[model samples]
Target: MSNHARELAGIIMNRFDAFYRRFLDITLGAKVRFESKDWLGVQLAGRQRIRLYDHHVNETLQAVRDHMGGAPLGQEGLKALKQAFNDRLTEHANPEIAESFYNSVYRRSLRHHNIRAENLYVHGFIRRATDPDLTPYCWQYRTNTGALGDCLRQVLERLQLAVPFSDLTRDLGYVDRYLQDHGPAELRGGEIGLTFVNTLFYRNKGAYLIGRLEQGGLQWPFILPILHDDQGGLNLDTLILSKDDASILFGFARAYFMVWCPVPALLVHFLRSLLPNKADYELYTAIGCQKHGKTEFHRDFLNHLHQSRDQFELAPGIKGMVMSVFTLPSFDVVFKVIKDRFTPPKEVNHETVKAKYRLVKQHDRVGRMADTLEFTNFELPLHRISPMLLAELQQVAPSLLSIKGDTLVIRHLYSERRMTPLNIYLEHATDEAVQDAIDEYANAIKQLAAANIFPGDMLFKNFGVTRHGRVIFYDYDEIAYMTECHFRDIPKARYPEDELSAEPWYSVGPSDIFPEEFATFLLSSPRIREAFKQQHNDLFTAGYWRQLQQNIEAGCFVDVFPYRRRQRFRFLYQQGNDKPGDGASPP
Candidate 1:
């Protein structure tokens, strides 16, 4: 051989060795494992085994060598060769081939751990395709198949496309037609009778279908079930309910959506804006009951009105009077309609009691009558009163009364035949008298606090004086915890070192309030100013006000009460000036 041929032969041998080493590394522990000893002694094996095995190995090695020629192995060249192998493996491991092999060997794997040919092909493909030197499987697949090729076709066949809104309507029509032709009688009836409502997707609330039922030319509102979505869309899986049962399922679905939905607080204002005058009144009444039923009349009247609407008519009675007394669980409100036949009383004296009785009796024959001469005490539960009712009472008479726990007892201002004296005085009292009354009220509150019983609401209206001038407290939205009272001087600007800012201001824990503020708030009244100075003046000062402010900010409003100051009323006869039996008046 010439010098060139010898160099070529050496290069070829080098190429063959490099290819064999690379192939061994890629295939090792997979199809073949090359022990160093076996690789060296391959030719020394017996004839039959040696001839068959060596021939196969030599043929594969020769093919690799020829593919490389005498070319010096470069990074690009090695990469190309690796990629080619991966591509071939991937083709053999395609799903069509894998599926066929899987079906064939699935039953055979019962006893032996028989591996399917598809799995073996896939394993080999993954091993080869994942090698760093190889081109990516996706790139190879794309280049080989083109954009509109087999892989794309398979994906399209597997995925169900979303239908457009227009298409959906068309399909729904087709469904109706199909039902008409072949569906069950019940299904056809449902389609015709039930209306298909529009679907909505609320951001926080979820999906809902709002439909109206048409029966006898009347439409009723209905809602569908709530729907949730991970990758949110109007996809089939996101359909909360099927069209067939959309009507029946809408109610629950609507409720769920409304409950879970993120509604803006301002929506309440928007809704109010749309309500008519009467509707607005009704809504106001409803919300007042739910939010502010602390006042007796508001709570009692609302309850009574609801009940009366169910039982009575609006016309006047034969006796020329209509009387209605309504009672809620905690309070009562009475409405009287008097006919022109009876003379109205100018003053609420004992002589006019018969007229008052007859007036109320005309409206509601079963209503209870008020005993102006006696002191009535009744305990009621708190939950029965609505907050709106309290608000209304506050507006009507802000300083005439208060509520404590469930009882709403009012003191009579003077003897009244038609109206209670307390009601007449409250309705007619001058603003100055009201203010003076409020001042005396403050002093009474201070005394009540000293008795270890706090009148929860300190509003001037919640306290009233009876015919005998005894102060009484009513309105009990918050009561109890009187025994836990502690008097402290609250600072105005500075907070006490012991007070923690962590607690809520409305319901601050007992230990958190500064006693000084309680003293300052008590001494704030002019009626109590001189008395407080003479008796408890040292307790009320600038330091006290500061501490009280801090406690108030910290939610110590309850601690400001004079818990020990509850007053006991003296009977009229006990005072030696009244004409009554054993200090008790006729009821």
Candidate 2:
């Protein structure tokens, strides 16, 4: 402590005693008969006890205004005190109990928000009369005013800043600038990190602290306690003006709190020898949150209230080994939250996000997914599809998707885009329709291959035939360029052990593929099997896909006409066999 600052603190403390004596006489009054509460030497006498507490609070503020001129404890200090008081007003376990010793203000005026009864000293403002170990008739609590006289007495003790309140909000801006200048990794290197008592949003009343931060080098293990306040995402501009003045507060608050409890940064440092590590923002928070559970472990009622069995979520995704089949009819359109990792779905790869750019040049038959949305988790983009856009499915092999803005809204599922999974729809489809669908499926594959696309998963589930008998591939998790894949022959078993092994004998990398595997996958049923064998026999060998891949890679452009031959204008009109200038045939 600097000599100059220590002298200012002493001046404030000396003046507190006289002011406390005067304030107590006013709130308690000259002639008021008290009830028989053993602790206070007299108990509280009134029915509207809560209102009287409010009255005492108002008087305390008024007294400060009367005695303490806008000098050391300016509006910022007073505001801090008020915010702390209001926080404690409603949530005290024992509102009546008070300090062990009394100067009229300590026992009669100043109120402590909470108390710990189990301790031998009964830590907090609780009087000896309320302590069972100290007194016999300690059942009913009477006093709430603890050591709160310090609010008026030692005003600038908590604030270790330049005097005269030249800049009430300078420290706040400093904290914000320090954080913005240094990333979380840099803060762990003996750097001081600042955290809010509550969040630093619009109605920010709680104080902030500057303390040393410690984080592990590996996996970035967050050593700082999960300070709900640290994640407020506020900036220096918040202290000035914000368009966000509409929403008042974010975190939970208690009932009728009146007094404030702002823990100073210096006091935090003073106790360093006993508690050396930075105040795990989560430590006091954990002690404060004995009533509820953290978000990951306890999903509250809102999670269940918004979900319905009727709603369908049709966006597709896979996280490593686990697959999220969002396009299924049984899908739930609710926003998914992934804890411990990124909360929302991250785009898996670069090409997946870039596909949208290439999609604009593709013909209509090359079905499109929802609009691509970029997320912070991955450098690529993921599809964000809306159920409302499903209305356009039949019209355009259809989908509606927006990438920007809050992508968490749940839209009502429409019937068209809610078409059953291709394999399931095939189960009840007519045999002729099944054959037509399989034929269209073959055409779609051949056309896509010619256009430099390869649907890595060639299962029936990935393709769906429209009512007009055109097959489209909607699943894109495993999609790739035709040139990037290797279509290889399944190696024959070279040793006896290979034949008996459960897995394949050949060494297969991620890009290595066997096109012959498509034959059995396409031949899942007898009718489709017979039809495919007769009509698309070439698809059974590795050579067919490889040839198509090579042709496309060699720059052989394949014209994918969307309309039928008869639907073309030239097909509808007859051309004369004569040279130019000959009259055209009538339509």
* Per-residue accuracy of model 1 over 335-404 as CA lDDT, tens digit each: 2221213224222333253433322212111001121211112222334434654443344334434466
* TM-score of each model, paired residue for residue: 0.20, 0.34
Q: 25-85 in candidate 2: lDDT tens per residue?
A: 3323212221111112111211122223334434444454455452334344433433343
Over the full model, what C-alpha lDDT does candidate 1 score relative to the true structure?
A: 0.29
Per-residue lDDT for 109 in model 2?
A: 29
| Candidate with best lDDT | 2
lDDT for residue 508 in candidate 1, whole number 0-100: 44
lDDT value, candidate 2, whole model: 0.35
Model 2 residue 412 CA deviation (Å) reads 17
